[model samples]
Target: MIPAAFDYKAPTTVEEALSAMAEAGDDGKVIAGGQSLLPVMRMRMNAPEVLIDLGKVSSLRGISDEGDSIRIGAMTTYQSVLDDASVKEHLVLLHKVVETIADPQIRHRGTLGGSVAHADPAGDVGAATLALEATMVIAGSGGEREVPASEFFKGLFDTAVDEGELLVALRFPKHTGWGAHYEKFVRVAHQWAIVAVAATVKADGGTISEARVAFTNMGDRPLRATSVEQALAGASATEDAVRQACASAADGTSPPSDLNGDADYRRSIAPVLTRRAVLAAAEA
Candidate 1:
């Protein structure tokens, strides 16, 4: 299979890209790195009339420190994330997850914004962003707008981005006063998660001051395990307490039963994975 014939535009500026997208309307699609989109296009899953390439837009690819957050350009590759000193010092959870995304080759081309925009439920970046409570910056014909991590993802293969909107960057809140870690369970060294968990725990003199738990591949979207977070609110940072809190991870989730594994298996493993993640984060 092959993508249908389409016009191509390499826009050097965000304003130009927005104008091109507005003109192309529903028949337009943006490509940055193209790690995932090209394969789907080759399979005929997406055949847009216009392909707007943002690869040459230098303004859309960089890492900078903002007042209260770290701004990562949409086209920043996963490998670059692994090497970013600011991200390593501030957003340690993301640093841990970037290494687990895929093999080196895939990491070299996969961008943070691309993963979030693609919104694959099983994607590590999506679940990590959810747990990190980040913000997504998007641009369109009208102007720029920020979408919260929780609201950015709508469902499997879907996002809050509207027509003519292109994701410009991701903003991760500072983790200066937090302890964080990311844990993923994959059958092989480089593969999609069987089930994954990301945990952020902030300590306040031996008591669990704050806790956040998020899951990957547990539903149609990357989700925060609110039940577990609520349960762990003020509990002692003990193994018993962590295990008990993890018990609530799959409470409201109708995890899919796909060819990878069954719903029962994912449900069963989610709590265990969450427990391990929380422990690692708490110890950090």
Candidate 2:
């Protein structure tokens, strides 16, 4: 397969990138890591007239620690995060999840922002971002705005990021090893998760202080199982309590049926999978 002939522009600045997008209008596409876009283009699924490359935008690449959260530049590669000593110390769960993101080659080339911007519901970054309650900073023609993780995901392969906007960075609350776990269900590595769950818990003297539960590929968007969270909070960090919370995973989801697995099977297995993830995270 061959892609449609298109113009390419690599911008070194945020303003320049936005301006390029504005000029190209609807026919222009932003290229971050191109991990997903290239494949789509090759398949002729998308035929952009112009491709705005963000590879040279310095402002969109790096990781920093904010007062209460970690701010990561959009261009940060998964490999960089994997090797980051700071991320390992404070946000180990993120590293844990990244380990399961595609394979080493993809990790080396894929940008975190690109993954989120692609808005694949089954992506590890999508679910992990939701579980961490992160915020995505998007800069557009008018100005900059932020979207919370819960609201950022709108549907499969869709997000709150608007036209002529570049996702600049991702901000997450400072994590101090709150029991965190990410469990992915796939027949093999590098496959889109049939269903995945990420769980984070804060424990105070063996009692659950706080809990966050997010699911991947269970619906049109990555979902936060708030019902499960509420049930786990302040409950004993026991298998029984984890099981109880897991039991309600499908309380509000409308999971879709697909070739990988059926809706009924995913619905039933999600809870059990989530329980194991919760327990693993609680032990962290």
Candidate 3:
């Protein structure tokens, strides 16, 4: 299907992009890579008066080490994150999650910021970022402000990015030497996760010291499995221990019922996937 006609502006700078968005007001939409938005537009689900493209925005397209954390530009592609040495060494969970995001072509074109900004519950990036406690940098006409990943995702297809604001970058604290794993369940290869878990653990002498667990497609937003995290602390890094801790993985989630599966089905499998994810992370 052909999308409705709209004015397009390819801005080279974030400021220019923001200005375009501001000028377009509520009818303007910001696009990066167009991996997610274009499809929606093509189906006539969204028709904005002005389309602000950030593809040429140089400032929003790189990765940098920020001492204690790593800063990834909003336009940084999934493939770039998978290839970065710093990401592999410091943010292993992110690298692992990025590796499972669709196939190579999607990975090359999908931007990290774009995925988070789109805030799809089934997306692979949001749960990992929520588990890592990443921070989002948003730019607006007023100025820049930082928002934590927990607060960044509001609901399905919704985020903290307002009408005239743009997500500039994401900052993730270095979790060096941490064992990380992303457990995704899909009926077919590269399909959106029916239920997925992201786990990153820090262990000492075979005992689990700390852990972060979050789920994708378990709710309207990426949900942190706090009960599981609390239970894993000071527990043995073994299959039985991880399985017991993950029993409550779906306790508070309200998963959607769709053609893929019903809410009950997702809830039933959450713990199974959580156990696999946590144990693998602990062993990594």
Candidate 4:
């Protein structure tokens, strides 16, 4: 398939990129990594009149530790993230989940901000950020504003990143010493998850003090399983207790049925994966 003809602009700075987007108005699309947008364009699903490329934007591509939180630039690649010592040491859940996204080549090219901005329900990174309660830093002509991960994803392929705005960085609160795990259910190697769970728990004296459970592909967007979190809090960090808590894994989800599996099948397997993820985190 061939995409429609469109104008393109490669900006080296945030200001230039924003100006380009403002000039193109609603007909422009900003591209970073091109992993998600290119495929959509080739299929004729989107035919933007102008394409603003952020490949040359140096400011949007690095990892910085800011005392209590880590700020990851929007254009930073997955491979870069996987290789960062700060992420591996403090944000272990994110480090574990990113290793499962696509393959090495895709990881080298795909950007974290791109995935978050794309807001794909099946994307692994979003669930981890949601579970960690990260913050999104958005930049536009009016200046910059921070949006919480919980309020960022509005629906399937939808987000709070409005027109003329760019996601510059993601700020994650440090989760040092927390036990974390990402449980992904895929049909084969290098495939998107049919259903995945991200679990992070803080345990004390063999009892769970706090827990954050998030699910991917369980709804129109990455969802926090509040019911499961509540069930696990204050419970013993044991397999039996984890299984009992995970029984409500699919209670509030609206999972989609596709070639991979039906809604009922996903619903039935949610608890299984949740239990596994929770137990792994507890044991870690």
Candidate 5:
């Protein structure tokens, strides 16, 4: 289906983009890589009067190292992240997660900021970011402010990015020397994850010292499995220990019921995936 006609603005600078958004008000839409928004627009599910394009904004398209952490521009594509040595060395969980998102074509066009802002509960990036404790940098007329991943995702397809604001970048604290893995289950190749788990662990002398775990498609937003994380800490990094700790993976989740599986089915699989993710991460 064709999209409804709309006015387009390609702003080369963040300031200009903000101005355009302000002028369009409620009728405006900000587009990054367009991997998500364009599909919705073509289906006529969304028809903004003004389409603000940020592609020309050169500043929003690179990855930079910041000592203890790294900052990824909102417009940076998944391919770019995959190619960055810093990301591979410092943020292994993110690297693993991005590699599983769709295919090469989508990865080349999908931007981190776009996925994060889209806030889809099934998106692979959100679960990794939530587990990594990433921070979002939102730009608005009031200047830039940061929101932690824990508070950034509000609900299904919703986020903390308010009106007249743009997600300029994401800041991730480095998880160097940690074992990380992303375990995703899909019905077919390139399909959205039916259930996924992202885990990163820190171990010392074969014992788990710290752990962070989050889930995809297990709730309205990517959720941290706090109970599992607590259970994994100070535990042995073996299959038995990991499986026992992951037993409560579905404790507080509200997974959706669809053709792929029902809520109960998803609840049953959460622990299985969580155990796999944690054990693999511990071994990495």
Candidate 6:
């Protein structure tokens, strides 16, 4: 299917891209990587008056190590992230999760910013980022500002990035000694997870000192398993303990009943996967 005819502008700078978007108003769509946007356009799901391409915006694509955190530019591809030494050494949890997103070919084109901005609840990256407490950077006519991951995602296919605003980067604090794991349940290779869990555990003297747990496909947006986190904190790092805490994995979630599985089926498996993830993270 061919998309509707539209004007396109490849901007080399953030300000220029914002200007194009402002001019196009609500009918403009900013695209980078095009891995997500192009497909929607081809299917005629979105017909923008102008497509602002950020392909030439070199400033928006790279990984930089700040003193306390790693700043990942919005246009940074999944493949680039997988190859970064800093990410592998300091943000190992993210490294593990990125390895499971789609296949090699898709990874080379899909951007972390695109995936999060698209706000697909089933997408794996959101859960990992949410668990990591990453910060999102947004740029618009009013200049730039930051939004925490907890408040960034609003609902299914929705986010805090308003009209004429572009997500420019993501900032992840260094995990240092923390151990993390991403557990996904996929029926086939490189398939979307029916239900997934991201766990980061910090152990002290054989006890879980701190724990962060987030869920994918559990609600309208990536959700922090606060009940599980509270239950696991200060608890012994054991399979039984993790299992007990994970029982609340589906407590506040409203998972969808789709072709993948029904809401009840997902609720049933959440604890099983959460246990596996927490156990693996605790041991790491």
- TM-score winner among the candidates? 5
lDDT of 3 by residue, 41-146 (tens): 9999999989998999999999999999999999999999999999999999999999998889998999999999999999999999999999999998899999
- Please give the range of 10 consecutive residues that has the lowest summed lDDT in model 3: 13-22
User: What are the TM-scores, per candidate, against the unseen true structure?
Assistant: 0.96, 0.97, 0.98, 0.98, 0.99, 0.97
Estimate, for each residue in 49-130, the C-alpha lDDT of model 2 and write its tens digit: 9999999999998989777888899999999888887777777678788888888999999999999999877788888888
lDDT of 5 by residue, 116-197 (tens): 9999999999998889999999999999999999999999889999988999999999999999999999999999999999
State model 2's lDDT: 0.88
lDDT of 1 at 205: 72
C-alpha local distance difference test of each model = 0.89, 0.88, 0.94, 0.95, 0.96, 0.92
Clashing pairs in 1: none
Worst 10 residues of 4 by lDDT: 201-210
Give candidate 1 regions above 4 Å deviation. none
Q: What would the per-residue lDDT of candidate 1 be over residues 5-117, giving only the tens digit for each residue?
A: 99999999999999998899889999988988999899988899999999989999999999789999999999999999989988888888888887899989989888989
Query: Which should have the higher lDDT, number 2 or number 4?
Result: 4
162-256 in candidate 4: lDDT tens per residue? 88899999999999988999999999998889999999988888999899999999999999999999999999999898899899899989999
User: What is the lDDT for 197 in model 6?
Assistant: 94
Model 5 C-alpha lDDT versus the unseen true structure: 0.96
Instruction: State the TM-score for model 4.
Output: 0.98
Pairs with steric clashes in candidate 5? none
What is the RMSD, in Å, between candidate 2 and the native fold over all Cα?
Answer: 1.2
lDDT, model 2, position 225: 90
State which candidate, 2 or 5, has the greater lDDT: 5
Clashes of each: 0, 0, 0, 0, 0, 0
True-structure lDDT of candidate 6: 0.92
lDDT, candidate 2, residue 81?
86
